[model samples]
Target: MSRITLELAKKMIENAEKEANQIGVPMVICVVDEGGNFIACHRMDDAFLVSVDIAQNKAWTAAAMKMSTADLARVAGPGQELYGINTTNNGRIVVFGGGIPLRKIGQIAGAVGVSGGSVEQDVQVAQAAVKIFEDFE
Candidate 1:
């Protein structure tokens, strides 16, 4: 399992930024390794100050859990397998669509998180970034 190089993390941020710009939303984007270690974090000029923390938490959650935050949100709801999971990890878990696990050959390498937009727009930006990473070696 290869780690997420700084180069790849930058690429993810660059692409995510483009998407956010096109959507007319400033954004905060973060990437974390499989161990939930920070690889990179970026915030657009007009992005909300609070979004920085949310973006980082989203990436951390996705990486630590080895799953997309969107998926986690599904199972983390009331009466679900991961109920109260958000309360764990000292509240790091975001359980939202903007965080996506980046996989290399079906193995988790890292995760990307985007914020400062609607959840759907954030997911779109994150998905674009992850798609680019998937095509890289």
Candidate 2:
């Protein structure tokens, strides 16, 4: 399977930044390869410093798990199937919105994450980035 290219990762970040700007929220965006390795990251002006780590971990979680962090959140809660799973990955797993796996030719290629806003806002930015991946040539 082909992995996400560096060019695509950058495009994802650019689209994410545009969405964040449109919403008036500075953001930290991260991309990870299929193996959960860091590919690229961007911190918008005025974004919180803490968002850097959050965004990276979110991308890692999505790539490693091969699922959106939002979907993971549903099953990671108390009494759910993946309960306490987040604590197993040295606390790097993020069980929330704002992380999504990127697919290429029907295969998971990588993931993108966004932070520096509310969960909903972050999710919006992340979704915008994923749209770039979806439309990639």
* Number of the top-ranking candidate, with TM-score as the measure: 2
Worst 10 residues of 2 by lDDT: 1-10
Global Cα lDDT for candidate 2: 0.93
Model 2 Cα displacement at 111 (Å)? 0.2
Q: Where does model 1 exceed 4 Å of error? A: none
Across 37-92, the per-residue lDDT of candidate 1 in tens digits comes to 99999999999999999999998888888888899999999999899999987988
CA-lDDT, candidates in order: 0.89, 0.93
What are the TM-scores, per candidate, against the unseen true structure? 0.95, 0.96
What local lDDT does model 2 show for residue 127? Answer: 96
Predicted candidate 1: what Cα RMSD to the true structure? 1.0
Residue 19, model 2: Cα distance from true site in angstroms:
0.4
CA lDDT, candidate 1, residue 107: 90
| Top lDDT prediction, candidate number | 2
